[model samples]
Target: MEIVQIFGFALVTLVFAVTLRQQKPEMALIVSLVAGAVIFLLMLRKIGAVVNVFNDLAARANVNLVYLGVVLKIVGIAYIADFGAQICRDAGEGALGAKIEFAAKILILVLAVPVVLAVLDTLMRIIE
Candidate 1:
């Protein structure tokens, strides 16, 4: 059912893209972006389900909830950043998309710094 919904959205977007190409090119780009956003929204429920599973697994493994939350946030950031960059590229703004990607990378690194430091601290303690 989910696959069908995704395919239907893709088909509609393809047709819209083709139709807008001859009339208003800018509209075509907007349609494509909106379509992508709609598809993402449709998949949100599945994403939630996956997150629930991850939570259960983390609990079973006695993992820190903070770590799991941070990892999930990082994944969300990556997904959104990729979506935005792809839309920018589709609109012929490749340079802007590249900048967005670079920003996303920097943000990810910033977010992971505490985790990295903690790991290093643990290693140093073991050495000591």
Candidate 2:
């Protein structure tokens, strides 16, 4: 079912791109972006499933929930950032897209700082 949805989106995107190429180039870009977004929406369920699996594994392993949450947040940031960047690129704002990517990276690093500090504390305790 998921594969079918993905294939359908790809086919539609290809046809749209080819058809719009000569008539309206701007519409082609919009079609491509909408196609990508449609595919992403379809895959969102899969991402949720994977995250659920990770949550279960973390529970069994006694892993820190905060760490898992942070990781998920980072993943979300990356995904949204990429989505925004792609949209910007589609609009021919390549420089703005690059800046968006840089911002995402910085945000991810900031979000990871707490995890890093926790690890450092654990290491210090072990050394002591």
Candidate 3:
């Protein structure tokens, strides 16, 4: 039902965006971006539910909250970056989209450092 709603909304948005694209290309892009934002907003409740499930799982598994938090942050960044990059590409700015993706990758790496370091440290202790 939610997906059906999302699809219906997207279809309507696509129609409007296409219509606007003919008369005012800039306006078309704005409409597309705003539609995307609305869709993301609509999905927030689902996202929160997923996060709660992950939190519960992490607790049961005895996983550190910090690492779980970092992982969630990384996923959030990836999704947001992809969304932005797609918008840029839609606006005929492929180069800008690529730059956004590059920045996101660097940020993900930075956020992952602590997790990587912890794994390596655990491995070292096991070997010793």
Q: Rate the local accuracy (lDDT) of all candidates.
A: 0.90, 0.92, 0.96
Assess every candidate by TM-score. 0.90, 0.88, 0.95
The parts of candidate 1 lying over 4 Å away from their true place are none
How badly does each model clash, as a count of residue pairs?
0, 0, 0
TM-score of 3: 0.95
Better of 1 and 2 by TM-score: 1
Cα RMSD to native, each candidate?
A: 1.5, 1.8, 1.0
Model 1 over residues 1-128: C-alpha lDDT tens digits?
77897898799889989898899988887888888889899889999999999999999999988888888988988998998899888888999999999999998998898888888999999999
lDDT measured at residue 82 in model 2 versus the true structure, 0 to 100: 96
Q: Which stretches of candidate 2 lie over 4 Å from their true place?
A: 1-8
Error of 1 at 20 (Å): 1.6
Best-to-worst order by lDDT is 3, 2, 1
- Top TM-score model: 3
Q: Looking at candidate 1, what is the lDDT of residue 23?
A: 96
Q: Residues 1-128, candidate 3: write the lDDT tens digits.
A: 88899999999999999999999988998999999999999888998999999999999999999999999999999999999999899989999999999999999999999999999999999999
- Using lDDT as the yardstick, the better of models 1 and 2 is 2
